[model samples]
Target: MNWYVVYTKPKWEKKVAEQLKNSGIECYCPLITQIRQWSDRKKKVEVPLFNSYVFVQLAESERNSVFQSVGAVRYLFWLGKPAVVRDEEISVIKKWLDTSDCIDVTVGGYQIGDSIQLESGPFMAQKATIQEMTNTHYVLVLESLGCVLKMKIK
Candidate 1:
């Protein structure tokens, strides 16, 4: 089975994940807790880590089954094909989320403007180009993904 990214309706990640699981599809919707405040009180609520995305592991022949879950819009497409996430990437996300304190990530001996492949954590396998290095962070440009990730050094 391969893991595919599912695009879901806004604010429906958790609900769709639950429905998929009940139907025997292995799905993951990573969540984080944040302090949401009203005018009178504060409460910690769980929110989707990546809004509108849920990961589902299934056989390619079973791809259409995901649509049975309400709020699942479609499979995310990259390069005109269904985006396939590596098993290591899924494991990394699970491990990172299980830990409360963010684990230490080191950029050993790498200088600014170096191109490197991450080997550890949830960002593993992401193509990154060094942008700027600071005492507290590593600014990386992910060209393939067309985004800059400002990662904090712990």
Candidate 2:
């Protein structure tokens, strides 16, 4: 069996996986806990590594069942038809699930002047400049009153 990525409805990773698994399809939903801060305090929360998506192990012949049987599942296309995630990617995720470290998916082609918010740290809530972009983080610059501030965002 090969692994295909399925895009699901918002906040429905578990639900979509359940529906697929109940129909005899194997699925994987990896999650990581991050510290989220509110106006008052910080809280730890678990969130999906890949938002609104899950990976299912299925043969090509049985792929259509994922869309027909799992109501929450929306599509499985990458460039064209169903996209098969690389074996190395699946293996890395499985290893992280066993060890429980933070996991993330990279979004490509993010350009300068693209609107972005700081995901964490001291610069939270202040509008900033995406001075530079990298595979894992951005070089952000912020202006505080009359002074300049800078930080890296991941």
TM-scores vs. true structure, each candidate: 0.77, 0.57
In angstroms, the error of model 2 at 48 is 0.8
lDDT by residue (tens digit), candidate 2, 28-93: 887777899999999998788777878888888987788855445555666677677766556645
- Which 10-residue window in model 2 sums to the lowest lDDT? 143-152
Question: Which 10-residue window in model 1 sums to the lowest lDDT?
Answer: 142-151
lDDT scores in order: 0.87, 0.66
Q: Tens digit of lDDT per residue, candidate 1, span 22-65?
A: 99999999898989999999999999878899999999999999
User: Candidate 2's error at 52, in angstroms?
Assistant: 1.2
RMSD to the true structure for each prediction, in A, is 3.4, 11.4
Those runs of model 1 whose alpha carbons end farther than 4 Å from true positions after fitting are: 104-127, 130-154
